[model samples]
Target chain A: MLSIEHLTLQLPYYTSWWRRRWAEVLSDVSLELHPGEVHAVVGASGAGKSLLAHALLGLLPEPKHQTGRLTFQNRALTAARQRQLRGRELALIPQSLDALDPLVRSQRQVSWAASRAGHARSDAWQAAGQALTHYQLDERGRQAFPHELSGGMARRVLTAMAHVSHAQLIIADEPSVGLDPQQRNRVLDALAALALEGKSVLLITHDLRHALPIAQQVTLMNQGRCIETACASAFRGDGDTLATGYARALWQALPDNHFGVLTTTQAQNVA
Target chain B: MLSAYRLHHAFADQTAVLDNVSLSLEAGEWVGLNGLSGAGKSTLGQLLAGHLTPQAGVIKVDGAAPPRSGLQPVQWLPQSPELSVNPRWRVKRILEEAWTPSTALREAFGIEPGWLNRYPSALSGGELQRVCVLRALAPGVRYLIADEISSMLDPLTQLALWQALRQVADERRLGVLVISHDAALLERLCPRRLTLSEGRLSPPARHGAQSA
Candidate 1:
């Protein structure tokens, strides 16, 4: 089980003059994801959702302030207490693919992840291969460098690495952002498969429609606060379903529709 | 106007990223390029903006061929934000590196006064992206090839950013080509849409459906 009680995070001090003026990043945020279920957090950009993800993985950057409780399977998460749970019990799929070491090969990164959980290198290699195949990655892709892989391929490799770590809880942040519709469905299904096997998932994204079909429950966040939390079924009705209403409101605020169109030559002349 | 004829680019391994791509964008048109990852939508956009050279075709911007290096007549916003701007530089400095001065850039970006001194790390993803759009638009470049600028932002922010881009296109009379897989977003912003398939561009039967 995963539980967070009133968890909060603050940005660290920076030498730059601008960093000092920005407001505290996260404030009094609290939510939870239970075993065998998918709890999705949907919010606008700059709402501190990513920071909350960082806080959960104990990966927040230096000099940040954090309070409240983070517990997995009844054990609290502290810098000291989380040492043993780093890989096996808790794992993170970060936003940037470059988060991995640039010098190391992709396969070695997955193997290293497994060894951190006390597995032998040979066993780790086999397990890594198995995970990669399970994720539908080409067997030969294991030898390729990060620079050689496409964005979607890199995401799959990261998932394979996460699987090798044997994490009880997986947190994926906007895992399908740049992928095509088909790839997005594949990635979402894989994560859903993990939840079916009793592993908890904290799926964070901005599109409620993307998560509504996959998530068992959904939490809508706006401006640093979670304004709504309910089962996906509650939003299934027609004509302004909760999810659609929010989406429409957000879409209407976009600047594209606000401006009138320009003729070809006039627009072209500006260049 | 932007046009490419019989465009082809091959990598060292003899793999073709863009194969004989032929497309054109008239002024005042909002074109959305749709493709699965690695479908080479970005490559075609780069070719139009003179960011990349095609091995076998001709590209023209406003009826003129562009040079390989230096700023071409068309402007380009790259895929990765980290690569789009210098991390160590302050936001103001990056914008200044473009053709515009500080006052004009701030006005176009809706940036509050005195916000330019902050570095990219200090800004949120949305803020950084807004800054990037401003920098790209600052040079007053006419043709814009924006490769998935909204992919990293949340819905609310994406909406805002698209609106800003649409306004720029209208005000500047710029030919804007947005590359993305978000069907809803494309439908909302673009009047003419093309799907990149097997390195070829074609109109989809349905406005925003994924063509197989």
Candidate 2:
């Protein structure tokens, strides 16, 4: 239910204490995310994937200039509107567990999210408990502070917070990083379950394999540029069905595939 | 050879994190260790690298105690490079802390010259990781304890890193202990693969793991 067309962002960088230089952080990126669809944005770290999430959430810092058109439900998405809709219609599943409060309990944190989204305190508490239970967190897990939870348990708590927000669109940035394979799959499966329930999910990550199975469409991003957006099925069987040469090379370089490292001439794109 | 003999470690008020664990790596050997989370793989690696002293065990380099101070022979590269680095320090100072690497080595690791002036917080996670790996490859180091270093990287960046490290390991006879959960990655880079579970090591069951 979101559409971005020719989006570009430039951040001002200080130079010599007297002048400012504009650095292109994102350029000419476009995508269409539909309801009930999980769209994967795959790129190397530092390819501006997180920046894209920030732009959508209206969290980008000041002294930034942009040229873009963001449409949600056929309505123009201004920065003020983005700020207003955040946590109500748009929720972000942050990449770091540090986003959680150290002193507060897990269930309380999740309920706070629900309350911020306009739920009454009593309803929010019940929703938080239900969300945590759906993620398989027992009563003890729900009551534990952030430090007490394991890596996987902490991740499930983040997912639970997003669930209570009841947002129409969710953005998860590198949600599976540092999680073991089993925990990684659990988080990915949870995101897929959200999409199954008709929430639009924007999964931004570097790992394509985990995203491919759950995502119907994939956007390949390079340094400040969107190289190609292709159907997830095109990533299979040597990636010959893929449109961009970079995507094919990336597919071939997978450890389980041909394990081909891009030659130096072509390495500049990913590096 | 770098070896750990009958290592034992346990946190206070808890059961043994490690139990009579022993492992050996000859020069230039590449070994992979995989396990479920909290299964003591990192504990074993830390014990081997001297980051954590096992309550009862001996770690030896060529059958002798390793040097107690200065540049260590075994370097540990953790999963999160950001936490490992000094955020206030510039990349140049960070890389030069242990030793200054040659330009050729920097190129191999894909470290850009412009990054040297930037703080660690300014660089992306992958770039910081490459810098950390290059920094750890000092002339005195002989073995590397790579704990999920490339698990955060994309496949292409992952391949690029292993390729570069392989060249140096071959030249320097560096023994590498790779700790990861990616069975496909373990299978590809290491000929001798072992799984850590319940404070013990065993050969991985080849049929169950998904390919990367």
Candidate 3:
């Protein structure tokens, strides 16, 4: 339902009152997410994964230049269109739990999202409770403030907020970071469940292992370029099916499959 | 050696965060501290780093209290580098404020010379973190407490930083305490590991026998 084509982002650095220089941060990146599929964009930090999310959401920093064709549901996505769809047809599960308002109660936060999605106040409140229940949060959890909840609980609450909005496309940026193993699985499973419900998901993460199980298509990124896009099933056994040497090296370097031989593709690239 | 005995700490609400906790690290040793979130591992690290004073218990390095001023022998690298840096100051000032890093040291950390004139805001999180790590590894430091210092970094940056740290520790015989939740990371870097649960410390399951 979502498609990005040859997206490039550049930030301008002012050298003087009249002089300026631009640095390219993202270049010629393209990907697509179909309805009811989880498309994972896997990359190391600074590979511009978050930048792609921001560019799609029209939240790039000022003095930035972007050129790309972004289409959602066969319609070109302009800045105004992105603003229109945000929080309704398009939602983001941000990387930081700090996205939740510290002063607001959890229930009110989810309800606000429901209200934003065009529900009446009374209906929003009911939908908020249902979302909480669906996410396995108890009544006490609904009443608890952000600071009072644990990290895992806060993550579920964020998911509940997105669920209440009923967005068609959900972009989760490293949602599992800082979470324990069980909690990580829970969050990933929730995203997978959302896909099963006919919502398209863009799962942006650094760990390949976390994305492989639920992701149908994995886009490997390096240095702001989409290095390779492969089926999740292609990541088995020595990674010969993987298109790029870097992708194969990445798979082999996993602790479970590490052969103790380092790939010389790039020292800094191989974490 | 760095050691803590019978450490007891509580928050403003009188909730005990750490109770009777004790641990010790010898020079040139790499030790891992593993725990669930909010398990008081950070509290213990802060106590040892002299950031917090425990209500009871004692922390000593080489049978003496930590120096009160002028280049601490024990340094702490917190989880977020953003909090530790001065936004208004240039990167050069931040690095030289604690100790002057040699050119080789700066080169080893991959800190660009151009970054010296830029503010912390101009650098990425990993770059700022490298500066923080270099600052903590200043000339006189004998013991380093890294509390989730690399949790935010990518695997490449994390490995690069850890390799630099390992080299420095080997050369200086520094005692390093690494706090993290990644068991595989601990297994690769630390020869000894300790698990903290609800204010108690025990030897990790996979790693045998705590050193007395």
Candidate 4:
């Protein structure tokens, strides 16, 4: 379980030339993620989803200001403990597939993760193989280097790492990004499967169409603020037209879709 | 122009990740590659772009083999735009690495002069992505391979980049192979689609058909 209270982060040098002017990335935002549940964070671009991920994982770059109480379960995660928790109690599946080590074999990176967490190399190999297989990766894939694999393969390798580490909490940013339709399904299914197995997932994405269906709870962030949080099933159903409206707005915002534009022009004409 | 003939590649005992896959692109053509996870879409792209060699097949770009491994005859805009840039390099230096002022690269992406000096870390994800794309388009390549280039971008930026890519490809008579999971975007951009499965390549199912 995870909980955040009155979190605020600012970066004075983010806009460099501005000097004394500080740019606020995340405002007084707060939320909770529970075991056996998938909490989705949704927002438009620049809504601070990735910024929040970096802050929560204590990976925010230097000269950044962070003031908040981040408690995992019940204990406060101070600077030192947060660093230790990054790869041990918490795991991250980065937005990019190439986040894997290009020079290292897929197995080696997993082994490194396991070894750093005090597990033996052989155990890590076995766990990595098993995790890869769980994500539908077969024998050949388990031995391939990062560059040798495709986008989807690299994603699967990362998912396998998350699973093998068995981190208590997994923070996945844009888990379905760059995947094809079928691969999107696989990635979503894998995350859902993890939730079903009692792991907590904080899925950060801008696409609600995919996350809304799979996540048990949803939190919408706008301009670094936690605007809304509600039950996923109910939110998709009758009670909350807001989430549905937002989803429709995003679908309309899709650049290549002429249908939305046509409909809007028609409405203007009729009016 | 780009073409692949009976391309086949694999790491080991398993079936080739790209099994005898063949495809071709002519000037001004925009193709989309779609498939399930681990189905070899990127592999096929890399092979066509000369990033990887086929174990038993042939690839030709403008009637010749690509110049180098991991190098595409066309420019490539990878998924993670932020990491693609060198942290210490200023945006001007980063953009300069791929383009020369003698070329019309800046005009293609509408990149104004002032943005060149800022480091990538200072920019937003969308901003960085745009820069990466502009850098890719800076060179006068006749073709492009974009691997989920818009995944990290927001809907607005996504749409803008989509239009820019289409426009540039048209203006330069360039061929483009865009890889993404967004079915709707693929439907809107590409007249032809390539579907991969079990490490094999073939034509996509009809529009609205079930996903692989």
**Largest DockQ belongs to which candidate?**
2
Q: Candidate 1 vs candidate 3: which has greater lDDT?
A: 3
Best-first order by TM-score: 2, 3, 1, 4
Cα-based lDDT at residue A18, candidate 3: 79
State every prediction's TM-score relative to the real structure.
Answer: 0.88, 0.94, 0.91, 0.75
| Top-scoring candidate (lDDT) | 2
True lDDT of residue A15, candidate 2: 43
Q: Is the docking of candidate 2 incorrect, acceptable, medium or high quality?
A: medium
What are the DockQ scores of the candidates, in order? 0.44, 0.67, 0.37, 0.36
Q: Could you give candidate 2's per-residue lDDT for residues A1-271 as a string of tens digits?
A: 9999999999876544678888898999999999999999998877889999999989988979989999987898899999999988999998877889999999999999999999999999999999999999999999999997877889899888888888999999898887788889999999999999999999999989888999999999988799899999998887778777788888888888878844642654443
**Ten contiguous residues with the weakest lDDT in model 2 chain B:** B203-212
Which pairs of residues collide in candidate 1? Answer: A255-B163, A256-B163, A267-B173, A271-B142
TM-score of chain B of each: 0.88, 0.94, 0.95, 0.85
The alpha-carbon deviation from the true structure for residue A222 of candidate 4, after best TM-score superposition, in angstroms, is 4.9
State the displacement of the C-alpha of residue A108, model 4, in Å, after optimal TM-score superposition: 6.4
Residue-level lDDT tens digits of model 1 in A1-271:
8887877666654556555533466666777788989888877766777777778877766776777898878878887656667677787777778866667767787888888866798999888778877888785677778887777878887877778888889888777777888888888888898889899988888766677777998876665666667787665423135443453344333333322222332243222
State the lDDT at B149 in candidate 2. Answer: 95
What's the TM for model 2?
A: 0.94
lDDT of 4 by residue, B1-212 (tens): 68778888897787678777778888889888877756777777777766666798887888887776543557666767787899999888887775654335565454557567677777766677877887776545878888888777655457657777777778889999988777777888888887777776667666443222
